[model samples]
Target: MSDAVAAPVLTIDGPSGSGKGTISRAVAAHLGWHYLDSGALYRAVGVAAGWNDIDLADPAALVRCTFDTRVGFRDAPGGEPRVLINDVDATDELRTETAGAAASAIAAIPEVRAALKERQRAFRQAPGLVADGRDMGTVIFPDARWKVFLTASAEERAERRYKQLMDKGVSVTLAGLLREILARDARDANRPVAPLRPAEDAVRIDTTGMGIDDVVARVLALIDG
Candidate 1:
């Protein structure tokens, strides 16, 4: 059989509310590449676990949930992609602080991360892929042709998340969101498996005051450069 070159991958990794999702989606659309929201997978698993009343502390149950959860995404041309869990539209729930917390909890479990690793890698397909998550560069796609780690100060990220939730009419306190983001950051950074960090050679962007279009252009410039 003739050898075929593998499709390229661009990874955008960062802590919660770091603009990874926004920038990754924009870049992917510009390049006409497939997109993978790895965080959504974990959130789906967490949501699935809760539906089955499976305890997050139970690693075994979480693994089963990972395998059993059927996660699908439907493109929403001008808005956030719809996340379906078990074919049910759970996009709203998935965007909740509760779901984010659940995802972080399950993500810290080594078993769950291991279970989801292959699933994340499989998103890399023909044309290319823009994979976004906490460990997209470090663990899921270490050899990705382009890798970017976007970060903003804790306060800034919290502010961004607050505004996002407010826009959706989800009541939330800025102080509470800040606390949650700090806690999740600690957990993700100290997690045993695939801790969140920039890959050694990955470009780092502190998008503390940058606009979405500016950030998107910078990332695209990398691949085009």
Candidate 2:
């Protein structure tokens, strides 16, 4: 961030099911700052492209999806983030495993990343911004004043995901979730573009057993001090 003009940004980067989304939202709300759910942007692009039957292999098609897609976030204090694509409520669909896989895949394309780079950065407005994603701190907001890398053991993350799905009445096995998570971990960590790793200046928070409030408080302290 350039000292002359850039607004403040607090980046929270992590893998799926790591509570990055939840924690970042809470912190943003608590601070009255705008929040960015960067993963949802990729997922929205993938889903919108799928709706139009755009070939995923064609980088041009994917690039067009980024421009044609309209994503909106409707979030309130003490509420879950709601995602809308093309003026339609896509919050539930965006949370599906299929959408996540698509996001992870399209995220590898250099064109796609280039397209969304400024889109993500535009979230930096007003008082501050709490941006959450796999590469927010490492790539999107490298100069953010506060950076947090939230993570958990694979087993623990899988368990957390299992409960969340079960609560939604979606039947899923724990073993399957764990296997999928590990697979995605390997994929994200080894992806050619923007691999999933913490920025050297980031504070790593292992959230394996800690509650949401505790993690939020820890991150808040980073900027508060």
Candidate 3:
């Protein structure tokens, strides 16, 4: 395989709780393509910085940390994929609300985004790639053959997140989760660097009332067409 050739990519961009992650994984699996969870990269960075007691507000420091960090993703024995930071399994650590908030804060830094750009793009391989992120279609894979923007109402998203957390035995209030979701949405959509907006050529899917299978089927039809 020639290293110079860019692999075709299917970009799935959306905010949190939009089912983009699950849908992207399904699409990648169906097409036998590599998958890139770009948000997990940021979350891993945030987790690593927290482990080292680094301040997120320091853009220069965060950028340096991003380059110095080594993030890996691999399937766990009986669960979802695991995230590794410097060989340490931080899969669970990176999913905390704290880490997510920290990630959002640092992702606003242009330097941090630039540092992770190539790393995220490297997942594209011979077969193809399915990239899921807030800006995958808008920035990371603008030339992607397929671009989708998934979304859901804030209330629905909050309920989904609350249920997810509760299932894992995490103590969190639905109202609080809703507030945080709204706050994160505001920050993500208003950020100056690659704000969370659908690409012009991207298809928008509101997953508020759709099941996973339904969403997947719709996306597959688009790809087939």
Candidate 4:
């Protein structure tokens, strides 16, 4: 097993719609480093179990399914991340509200997190790794060279989510989206395994009013410095 000290990692962690995903991807692209969307891994597990009719509450069953399953990410031309589960293109399937909620639930389980820990860490390679997820900084990549916690107001996040879904042709009301976002945030922050929080040394960026380019530029400066 490789020690955290052996490789450099940049972790960007925060709640949904805080632009962590987009920022992390851009950072990885700018730095020519690898990227890991850790949340997608849990979502893939939830999706696989759902397809097989396995009960998510069953820890033993989830552990078996988590290990037996294989998940991978592929960049699409212009869209959200594509998730491939067990060789099948489940890009669209894994993005639904159901999958996201299921992922949050499963991620709370100790055994499930234990199963995916090494897989997430293995993304650290020669150049570096930019990891994005709720716990990337708090847990998975605690020793990261640079850790950032990107966040925005709940209302702002909901609006962002609403626009994203609408742009993707998914019909969703703003109020409904707001409620869901709040609920998920509460759950994620209260989970026992790796509750969402900024690492002690993490730089917190409130992207509520910042432009993407500005945020990227600021993050780049931090990385360079």
Please give the lDDT score for candidate 2: 0.90
Candidate 4 TM-score over all chains jointly: 0.95
Residue runs of model 2 more than 4 Å from their true location after superposition: 1-4
Per-residue CA lDDT of model 3 for 1-225, tens digit only, reads: 554246788899888888898899888888888889999999988988888888898888888889889998887654557889999998887888998898899989999999999898788787888899999998888888889999999999989889988998999999999999999999999999999999999999999989999999989899899
Residues 139-194, model 1: lDDT tens digits: 88888889999999999999999999999999999999999999999999998889
Model 3 TM-score? 0.96
Global Cα lDDT for candidate 1: 0.92
- After TM-score superposition, what is the CA distance of residue 6 in candidate 1 from its true location, in Å? 0.8
* Tens digits of per-residue lDDT for model 4, 41-97: 999999999999999889999999999999987778665567889999997877788
Worst 10 residues of 4 by lDDT: 1-10
Q: Per lDDT, what order, best first?
A: 1, 2, 3, 4
Pairs with steric clashes in candidate 2:
none
User: Regarding lDDT, does 1 or 4 come out ahead?
Assistant: 1
Residues 83-144 of candidate 2: C-alpha lDDT, one tens digit per residue: 89999999888888888888888888889999999999888887889999999998998888
TM-scores for candidates 1 onward, in order: 0.97, 0.95, 0.96, 0.95
Error of 1 at 222 (Å): 0.3
Off by over 4 Å in 3: 1-6, 77-79
Q: Which stretches of candidate 4 lie over 4 Å from their true place?
A: 1-5, 78-81
| lDDT for each candidate structure | 0.92, 0.90, 0.89, 0.88
